[model samples]
Target: MRTRIITAIVALAIFVPFVIKGGIPLTILISLLGVIAVGELLFMKKRLLVSFEALVSFVAVVVTILPNSFWRLLPAPAFLNPRTLIYLFIFLLLLTTVLSNNKLSFDDAGALSLGVLYIGFGFHFFLQARAENWMAFVFGLIIVWLTDSFAYIIGRKLGKHKLIPKISPNKTWEGSIGGTAVATIVAIIFAESTHFATHFSLFEIVLATLVLSIAGQFGDLIESALKRYFGVKDSGTLLPGHGGILDRFDSMLIVMPIIVLIGLTA
Candidate 1:
């Protein structure tokens, strides 16, 4: 717990500054995070296969996150868009699998491709959300953090029914409910206390909060599933108590994309 608190403090120290200075600094910070996350995903596989997948994932993330202006500055053709790059990398992974004579199975190829797209696109949306509205981004982060914290605390104290014992044994239905309730209250308070209510209707704010909170929980479960599949406890040991970049930001990964989508339509 002490380690977790310390890590959170240190993370906020670095994160808050970049968030406030949201420009090249934020871009660079997020890009580095994306790279590290991709590296951790690739590290799930054997060492021999890690290099190829890591390189491909890194390229995919860079393509996804780079601004249109950056692409324009390059003399590359119009076909060099993010979608094309992702598909091309997937194709290459498939080819590598074939050439390896079954050393890399179809499952491995598919997993690698999915990892690249998932991690890359997740950060892509995160960058978009931050670019769209820093306040909204901060709000989303608060919701995710509070949900996770409340769930842990409440679950450990009063939880009985297992939410998903197969995926995450520690999580409980009571915890999930408590977390969502607390997060929703926070959202309401945040809306009333800040300018969020003025920009968004009360209904829209409530709906977005509910969706983000639930999505955040599911996101954590999804990461837990991935770790389980990889036969690992944590994604990486980069963060003392939190685990890795993915472990730390799994909720944000899902929340950011949903928030961006909601922001677009709302």
Candidate 2:
């Protein structure tokens, strides 16, 4: 518990400044984080880390996380967009299987490809959220933290039934419900106090916060499921008590994309 709190402080000290700055620095930090996240997934697959497939996966992740404005840096042949480049990198991963004499395997390629997309888009939208609006982006962060904290507190005191004992034994349906309900109310209050005040109706605010609160819980569960499948206690041991970059940011990876989408439609 002491280690966890200390690590949180240290990480926030480093992370919050860049988050507040919100430019090249933030982009670089996020990109590095995305790469590390991909590395975590690759490490799970073992041998693939040393293979050519890893390179392709890393490049694809970097490209996927680049903002639309950054594409201007790509010289000439304007039709070769980010999506095209990403697909090309994925194609390289697929081709690596044949080139490696099938040692790499199609299954390996599929896994790397999926990891690139999931981690890539996850971080990409995270950057997108920061770029779009601080208040809006922070909405995702606030809800996730609130939900997780409340769920833990509520679950410990009153939880009985398992939410998904197979994946995350500690979580409970009661806690999940309590967390989301509390998070939604707090998030709505937050939105009311922020930019969401002018643009959203009370109904709209309720609907959006409710969806985001629920989505945040699912995000944590999804990461828990990944770790369960990999037979690992945590995604990695980079953060000591926190486990890994993925462990700390798992909810954000899932919530950021949803928040960005929510912004788009709203």
Worst 10 residues of 2 by lDDT: 257-266
Residue-wise C-alpha lDDT for candidate 1, range 133-232, written one tens digit per residue: 7778778888998999999999999999999999999999999999999999997788768775376878778887888899999999999999999999
Instruction: For candidate 1, report its TM-score.
Output: 0.92
lDDT (10s digit) by residue, model 2, range 102-129: 8888988898888888888989899888
lDDT of 1: 0.82
* Local distance difference test, each candidate: 0.82, 0.85
